[model samples]
Target: MHSRRHPIRNAILVIVGFVALAGEVGAADLVAPSVQKTLEASFSAKGQATLARLAQDKTQGLCTHYATSPIPAKVVTEITAMGFATIKYPADGEYLGDWQRGEQIAQSGLGKQSSDDVEKPAGGNCYACHELTKAEIAHGNLGPSLYHYGKLHGDNDVVKKYTWGKIYNAEAFTACSSMPRFGHKGILTAAQMKDLMSLLFDPRSPVNQ
Candidate 1:
């Protein structure tokens, strides 16, 4: 017995298939000269959000250039090296700060907008991408659950340095990482970075407990 296929369902499937194909074609054509000109004309710099921010760095440029395909191994190495070069270590050889302040900084999602005050401190907004503590139920899962960060990775020189580097410039450790280069881009202060380090390293921090 031949089962009858639903014509409406088949039609919908065909439409969806064409839409997907169109989307792929659109993606490939998005970087065309006309699109670039439109984008350039559409945006204007405001406050700290300068027009220069729209310009991609070498790593970003490579990522954009290879958006439709796999990035070459040589290009990946180049990007990783470029990202690594941006990292700046602490001057006084200190890597920790108040976990209490760190918690505040991580939880608060503020600063770095055109409307925001440039003098004010920017937030890490850690909660937006990670689950730091069991107490905080409201959190996103874009990144790994760092609930027992310090407990999992013991407080040591190597661990501390690695954590700092990761926060400072995530692409330095993982090429094309979504995490912002907070320290490298001057988005977060040294003190703020140290506080975040404490949040991740201090045994007493909520991240550990």
Candidate 2:
């Protein structure tokens, strides 16, 4: 006499058993190359989204390989060093811009996509992965909420620099973070970054309030 498993649990167990039979790592190695090739062949380039998007850079390749596994200490060091080296601080001493404009940037989800207009400047799309403001009920929970970020962490020079660097290259702080390299990749302009900074750190900003 044994307890019965739920339908979904049974389905998952079957899949796990199949993977175990195939040898987990071995199956991944055998199928990944074919899957990558198929993806490359099937996906078409459009607008600013070129076929090069399929190509994995050094960091991307490493991250993808370790997606389901714990990264080695040496590899973590290497990845963070690579990411940190790419960060470029603002030439102008100013770190904060208009918070009102920052709010708009946070709300905007426009950026590089197949159908998007190439001429238009891409947005930060911050809210898509973060809970930024109390006023904006529609927000994602993928990343930690930055509501009262400035209040929680005082606006000091150290905090400012660290914030700027994190926004620039998230991988610099956390290896294999899903956050985009907005500043490092030139996805956002210096002025735009400053505005976003204000959105995060300004006392008057809705995020801080």
Candidate 3:
């Protein structure tokens, strides 16, 4: 007769293995082949999600490795540099679209879920992690309140570029940030990004009002 192992025990083994491997490896990489294999074995492909999701990219691998301790300045610099290199500015030099469309994008949380329509454009889902307006009482506190964002930052080329860059690749500013790489990873299109820009920069937007 055989006994099935407990899930927590298996997790602990992975962590222990990670520590041992870290001592041998220069970077404290957590996604060992075994770890990835285990993760892949747990989930079957569903809808838009695939086994490829189990694989970690360089940034993700680095972030996971450094989760237990502070990242060195060298690694931080590398991460930010990689992020900045991935941004692609609009051809027309425009940084904003309609604020009304932006409002809708910010409010929607659809697009990336397993059941979401892949053909449809993804939403910014901004309110999930930020307070964008006083009227909307429901908002998460994970990220900073963005209400009055335009009033506080002021409108200018510098502000506009910074805002666009930040949205495109937040990790360029704050390494290992949980914010989605909306532009860097092509999660949001150029037009969608402009709309989100308007949501933050337009005076008439609820974020400013």
Q: Distance from true position, residue 59, model 1, in Å?
A: 1.2
Q: When superposed on Cα atoms, how far off is each prediction in RMSD? A: 8.4, 6.3, 4.0
lDDT of 2: 0.80
Lowest-sum lDDT 10-residue window in model 3: 19-28
Model 2 stretches astray by more than 4 angstroms: 1-36
Question: Which stretches in model 3 have alpha-carbon errors above 4 Å?
Answer: 1-20, 23-30
Q: What's the count of clashing pairs in each model shown?
A: 0, 0, 0
- Of 2 and 3, the candidate ranking higher by TM-score: 3
lDDT of 1 by residue, 40-133 (tens): 5657889988866655565665565555557678767877888888888899999999999999999988898899887889899999999998
For residues 1-209, write the lDDT of model 2, one tens digit per residue: 12476644443344334333444233234224545565566668888899777666667666655655588898799889999999999887889998999999888888787888878888889999999998898888889998999999999989999999999999999999999999988889989999999999999998988
User: Looking at model 1, which ten-residue stretch has the lowest summed lDDT?
Assistant: 22-31
The number of clashing residue pairs in model 2 is 0
Q: TM-scores for all candidates?
A: 0.81, 0.83, 0.89
Best by lDDT: 3
Residue-wise lDDT of candidate 3 within 122-208, one digit each (tens)?
998989999998888888989999999999999998989988988999988889999999998777899999998998989999889
Off by over 4 Å in 1: 1-34
What is the full ranking by TM-score, best candidate first?
3, 2, 1
